[model samples]
Target: MAEIRLENVVKRFGTVTAVDHGTLTIEDQEFVVLVGPSGCGKSTILRLIAGLEEMTEGYIYIGDQIVNYVEPKDRDIAMVFQNYALYPHMNVYMNMAFGLKLRRFSAEEMDRRVHEAAAILGIDELLDRKPRQLSGGQSQRVAMGRAIVRKPKAFLFDEPLSNLDAKLRVSMRGEIRNLHDRLKTTTVYVTHDQVEAMTLADRVVVINQGVIQQVGAPLEVYDHPINTFVAGFIGSPAMNFIDCRVVQDGPNILLDGESFQFPLSATKDGMQIFSHLLGKEVILGLRPEDIEDREFVKDQKEGIIKATVNMVEPMGANVHLRVASGMHHIIACVSPKTRAKAGENIDLVCDLSKVHLFDKETEKVISKSPITG
Candidate 1:
């Protein structure tokens, strides 16, 4: 396995910038994922590293070698694409062995590598089957096997499971993670799905509009987002943002808005930053899970606020509810036991310790508290 690095990487499509000043380092044996919305340059960045697309201006390094001048074959990298670009005429064994044949490996060497990779991918049983006979997941595995057989310095995956059904995608997610663990090959995977990025990556690179936004472990980025874009992008239902001005009343700092005015509680973790935003316009970010049904937090309650229920979404184990405190509409993930419904006013208390505060202009997180419950 080898480390990959991009320095001042810039890719342009005439007037439009596909990747802007992209610079990042992928450590040896690291599973790094590049994630963002479409037209965000994720695929272009991957192609730059794979030597598939030439950068307008930048340097890509594989290990200690600068690969800008190197051909894809000489770069020692294998890529698995969103579409399983398999040979329909060839069976699984031939498909996996084709790369080795192109490299002119001995017959025995090709057989050994093909079978080993098939075993690793658990596709040995389907070796004789053609791509037409295999399911979407199987075809994906074969695509991966094609890469694995090469024993390249690194692996590049571009939404390899996008074609599979939701159920199969979920199952394949686990399989891919397991495969990475066993192989421990330095890998870079690109996807727009936050769930896939969070679950599969050793480090997730959040990019937007051809620029790097944040790079961190999944939980680190989720808990401490750099800005509003990432705050809304990383989470499942996402954090709720409410516009309000701060009001200092006695020892408490209150957030006043058209709908409601509430005191901001200071937690031990965020006391340092909380002291700075005394009377300023700040955005309040609360996750759905951070706001709980009063009944659940009452018995094991920490901090609570009362509001009127606007809507309720029953999601199996918990109910997602939208509530209005004044003019502010917030979402809360409460216990399925919550009997409150729409058109009803209820006390919806938020775990203040779990709340996040961000600057209105910069959109940067100013303070956050860790919640145990």
Candidate 2:
């Protein structure tokens, strides 16, 4: 295993910059995921690290060696592509053993490595099967086996499970995580799926428009996003944002939404944080899960909002509500027992302790509530 480092890495194609001055470090044996939307330069960063794309500027290091000009074969990294780049003509065993064969390993050594990898991936019985005969998940396992046999310093995966069905994708996610845990090889995975990044990564590097947005553990990023982009992108159902003005209602500070208003809970931290923003417009962010049906809440008097339910989706464990309160459209994930129905007025209580405030102009978070276990 090796620690990988990129220092001010920049990659540009003519006038378009794909990666802009990115500097990060992947600790030895750590699983780091590069996550963002499509065309956000995550794959480009992976390619740059794997020596598949030349860096327009800056340097890359594997261990202590600078490898800006190193050939891909000499970089000691194995890459698994989204398409599972397997040989159609060769069976699983041969395909997995081909790299070692080219490296001129002894026949016995190659066989042992291939068998070990096959067993680890639970593909030992499928060794004689060709790529055409294998299912998508099995084919992916073979591709991973190919990478594992090489015993490289690091592994790079570029959306490795994109082609699988949803159920298979979830299954493969657990398999990949288990593989990483057992092997403990330094891994860099790239994907646009937030769920995949959240589940597989020890640290997630969020990118947007060719720039690094935030890097943290999944829960850390989910709970305390630095800005609006990170806040909206990392969570499922996305956080709802409402534009409101900070107003003083006598001695209490409140967020005024024109049609409705709620007093800021009298927490010492809340007072200190919102005192300076009086009379200025700010964006209030609330996660779907943080807004609950008032009937289910223990304290129904605080942070109450009345809205007309626009739509209702009954998920197995929870009901998702799309409601309109004044000019804001909000989504709330309430308990499955919620009596809220479409076209009816409902009362929802916001968990003020979990509120997020962002500067209207900069869209950067000014205050985020502490995360509880």
Task: Output the number of the lDDT-best candidate.
Answer: 2
Off by over 4 Å in 2: 265-270, 370-373
Model 2 C-alpha lDDT per residue in residues 29-115, reported as the tens digit of each score: 999999999999999999999999999999999999999999999999999999988999999999999999999999999999999
Candidate 1 TM-score over all chains jointly: 0.94
Consecutive 10-residue window with the lowest summed lDDT within model 2: 364-373
Candidate 2, clashing residue pairs?
none
Candidate 1 overall lDDT versus native = 0.87
Give the C-alpha lDDT of model 2.
0.92
lDDT for 106 in candidate 2 is 100
Each model's TM-score? 0.94, 0.97
Model 1 stretches with alpha carbons more than 4 Å out? 265-276, 299-303, 370-373
Q: Write the per-residue lDDT of candidate 1 for residues 1-373, one digit (tens) a residue.
A: 3999999999999999999999899999999999999999999998999998999998999999999989989998999999988999999999999999999999999999999999988999999999999999999999999999999999999999999999999999999899889888999999999999999999999999999999999999988888888899998788889887776666555666656555664444333445567668988788888778777666644445668888989999999988887767788889999998898988777766677778999998876762333
